[model samples]
Target: MSYEECVIVDIDGTLAEFDAEAVRQWVLGEEKQWLPFFEHMAQALPGVAVARLVGILSAQQQKIVICSGRPASYQHYTQTWLEQHSIPFDALYLRPDDEDHLADEVVKKRLLQRIREDGYQPWLVIDDRQAVVDFWRAEGLTCLQCAPGDF
Candidate 1:
């Protein structure tokens, strides 16, 4: 597909309900409770409106690419969740396992490079994080913020 036809979307807080409090607690805590955090997120409910919008875009022939700060190590769970929810996506990109310590925007920027290399020219992005939204805009792509992402 041409670059103008591809759209990027985020998983957490965009397509799925994100528990900010749980994430904040985990981030503030010293221990790395990654497994539990991932498990909790795996059961997150889908964002109906956003999912419908994505479906509409897909029906219109826009290539949907699922991109997120979620770790690649838990890709199985992410993929299963997406499949179970019937969210259409042409590709899924997640933060590398070793790069989990990096900020969301940094990780996504690296993923963007990979996406371009894979022959997708993403024209728009749907995300719910302030930093990430800013990053996408800085990179000259239109980004729609689906929710308050100031956390």
Candidate 2:
């Protein structure tokens, strides 16, 4: 397919349910706390109903690219969850494990740039964060801010 047919979507709060409370607890820990929370999230968080959107895009012969702020270390669990939930995706992008401390918007912006540089002419993005949506809009990209209820 061509780059014009590709769209990007976020994971947490968009396509999957995230345990913010658990994440807060994990962040409060002394050290290596994120590890346990990562494990917990991998198994606990549920997938939202993205099949409808996937089907719609599929019918249009468009591509769905998953772009998440999740660390690369969790890529395995994330992929497994997507598979189990039957969420269709043409590509998956995650944050580098070493840069987990960076802001989500910054990381996502960089990722988006990389995607464009890699030849994906994404015209639309579905994200849960208003900041991300705003960023995309500022760059003249179409974006949808997905509310929790919209999932």
Best by TM-score: 1
Candidate 1 lDDT, 40-73, residue by residue in tens: 8878999999999999999999999999887888
For all candidates, what are the clash counts?
0, 0
The candidate 2 region of ten consecutive residues with least summed lDDT is 25-34
Q: Which stretches of candidate 2 lie over 4 Å from their true place?
A: 1-4, 27-32, 44-49, 148-151
Output the worst ten-in-a-row residue range by lDDT, candidate 1: 25-34
lDDT of 2 at 78: 84
Deviation of model 1 at 51, angstroms: 0.4
TM-score (C-alpha) between model 2 and the true structure: 0.82
Tell me the spans in candidate 1 whose CA falls farther than 4 Å from its real position.
Answer: 1-4, 27-32
lDDT, residue 34, candidate 2: 60
lDDT of 2 by residue, 18-104 (tens): 656557667433334666766776675444455567658867888888898788887888899888877888888998887777777
